[model samples]
Target chain A: MKILVLMKMVPDIVEELEVASDGRSLDQEYLRFIVNERDEYALEQALLLKDGLGATVTVVAPDAPEVDDVLYTARAKGADRLIKVTGLPAGSGARATAAALAVTLPAIEGALPADLVLSGCQAIDDLDGFVAPLLAGALGVPYLGLVSRVSVDAAAGKAQVMKEFAGGVMGRFEVSLPALLGIQGCEKPPRYVPVAKVRAAIGAGGIEAVEASAGTAVAPVEVAALAKPEAAGHAEMLEGSAQDVAEKVADILAARGLL
Target chain B: MAGNVWIVAESWKGSISDATYEALALGRELADGLGVRLEAVLLGHGARAAAASLGRADGVLYVDHPALADGVGEETSRALAALAAARGPGLILVPTTNVSWDLLGLLPARLEAPLVNFCREAVVSGGGVEFTSLLYGGKMAATVGAGAGPVVVAVLPGVRPAEAGKGGAAPAVEEVVADFVVGGGVRWLEYEEPEAGDVDITQQDFLVAVGRGISNEANVEVAEELAAALGGAVCGSRPVIDQGWLPLVRQVGKSGATVKPRFYVAAGISGAPEHTEGMKDAELIVAVNMDPSAPIFSVAHYGIVEDATDVLEALAEAVRKRKG
Candidate 1:
């Protein structure tokens, strides 16, 4: 089985995110990016499948700041191929990224078409977890998302995937190969790869790059302004013992007739 | 963008979802603003009878098909696309949900239309709809201008009240029969309910929502005692549920249950956006954590910087004393 994992970098929320002076985009100065939380989980899932059923794992990503480090880390973590697609329209939303990937992925040289594609259900930046399904639509394949568990029967050209629904409902689905899934999580926590291993992967020669052909035509919504949500209220710090805070909370609740 | 405003009415497990009504409430205002009709596209199997509940919509486009029951994105998007292609809607609003999130991605690609996702609000501006979406979870909000074409907006929860969309004259129902062709691949097999049943956290009046700060399974008893004293139930953030400290039903987060109880006591949660999305609207929030900079304080009405267990124990005592 050949599995392709799509990953990307998003603003690290721990650092304060600032709106650009233009007010339409995020301020890039003094910003940091981390591998999207769930995409790392998708890579872990693909690697687990590789360890069990012997599949070749390829990590694909749209070009972004510090993405090369994320790609090298994926290789260190057992991904077999790393291909970065560049020249995507800067400042595009997740929809454009998905559209561009749909158009550009199939055109990459030496990267065989994948039987199954896995990507984080959504990025922290866009919070639009539709990349897998959008790409699948363009590729004319079936897609399932919010998947947590997966097992492939390569001989039969089929896969069994477990999806998560609201209220913790788990729906199992069977899909033919050449499918894509937006992974919500893996069966296990993502394994940590030491920095030494990632450095070795970089020494082994960094990732391959694919130039996005000019004028990829996915119409993206233009952000007119960006700002932090107005803080509704701040906590009135109830200091002293727990009983003091609890007493104050209970009094507040009682005042509101909730007690 | 020059037609009626349409909302994809989401029905699941044989009933209309609250999120659907919420979208309807928003759609009604947008339609009125645009001086066009508000329509609902209801797709389900044997679910056509529920159309009467969608009276806020000016018209109901109900389509019943066995394939529509499972909410497979391709089938749903195809069915909606076929109908929209024929009837030219100026704006479409879909609630961003598990049932419809897949199509939020698929429909835009197939229609070649721009999708505004994570959308929180939309208003009439310059004779067009401009949207505001919460990006990077909820840290940053972006205003999106609708370009010169029909656009689909995925409305977020908590924008408009579902109550406003509940009562209206029965809408005219038009049964739509459209072709829903899909790749013969993905098929829903079985559904596993969460750990039989515990408590429907969504219905709770008071919630003691613990996070990773609780530490271990044994510590859950501390929360239970606190909840008992407060005459409420115990719930947790995703980490506590993922750790098996609480059942999935007791989880309060984006993927779990959204709760706006009368009183919420948060402990040890760093307030990730996913978790905050579910419970930020609680009537009153009291947070306890050691970290001074924990984001939970941002939404909390009261806070105590202390160990969760120590605080929980004291809170229980205080509540017990107050009740006694």
Candidate 2:
């Protein structure tokens, strides 16, 4: 079985974000980029499928300085191949990215025996959570989102997937092969790869670059402005010793009749 | 030609969800601003009655089908696409729920329309709609404008007052028989609830929730003791549940149970949008986290920037002292 994983690099927002002078985008000069949180989970899910079913894993990601390290790390962590698509404009929305992937994934040599495609359920940067479904629509395959578990029946050419619904309910469904799944999490935490192995994999140099064709399609949505949400600023910060804060909390609870 | 603004009402188990009313409230504002008719589209088995509940809408496009009742994404998207093609609504508002997310993902591609998900606010501007979406998990907000007409938006639930549209005459219902196929590769088997814990957190009057910042499973007892002292239940964010520190029933987040407890204390959660979406509606929120910039602070009524473990220990101790 051949499985493809779509990963992305996003701005690490641990620090405070500064809106650009244009008021429509983030300032890139001081920003640091890292692999998206859930995309790591996606890679892990793909590797799990690889281990269980003896499938070949190919990882694909948009080009960025951080993308190289992510790709190298994927290679060290059992991914068989890495393809970096370059030349796409910055700030490309989820739909455009999905469109490019749908076009580019099929054209790569030796990438085609792909029976399943997995992507992170949502990118912290976009948060639209539409890429996988859009990719499935572009590829004309069934789409499943927020999937937590996946198992394949290679002999029957189908897969059983489990997804979480509202109200803490779980639904299991079967879909034919060559489907796309937006992975939310896996059964286990993603395995860790040490830095030395990733460096050695980088030295081995199996990374391939594909120039993404320009002008696929413009994103329907255009950013009008970007701003920090107005802070509520009403929070009464309880200061002093931990015991004092705790006393204040207990008093509030008592006043509310919760105790 | 200007088109009507349509709010797609989400129905579950033969009733319209609160999210649908929220959409109606938002749609009324946008439609009135654009000088267009605000309509609602309901698609589910026995959805007409639910459609009639949307009195704020000028009209209701009702599609009754069993396949829609369970909300199979593909079928629902196809049905909505068919309705969009026929009616040509300028802006289609859907609630940001699991089903709507799935349907919106496919519908945009099928209709080749732009979709903005998790929007907190929207406005009509220059023959199009501008949407404000929370990004970086609500750290920053971005205002995006879609081009021209026929754009779909997924509005964040609980942002609008559902009561704004409460008092009005029943909307005129128009039955729409759109052409779409229902069954194919995907089939829903059954709904299995998460394992039940000793207390149902959803119905709790007060809750003390923990997150990964609590460090490990052993620290969960600190939260439980505090809850016990306060006569409340203990819940945790997804990671805590995933770590086996708490059962799925005690999990609070998008995939978990949404709660509106009278008092909520969030200890150590970094306030990811998924976790906040479920508990932000509590009457009062108290946040304890080492990071002062944690998004939970944005919605918190009171905050303490301190080590969560230290706060938990002190709170538990204070509760014990109060009981004594």
| Number of the top lDDT candidate | 2
**Clash pairs of candidate 2?**
none
DockQ of each: 0.59, 0.63
Each model's TM-score?
0.90, 0.94
Tell me the TM-score of chain B in each candidate. 0.87, 0.94
Candidate 1 structure quality by residue, lDDT tens digits, B72-105: 7768888888888888898889988777777787
TM-score of 2: 0.94
Docking class of 2: medium
Candidate lDDT values, in order: 0.81, 0.82
Give the lDDT of residue B266 in candidate 2: 96
B55 Cα displacement, candidate 2 (Å): 1.9
Q: By DockQ, who's the top model here?
A: 2
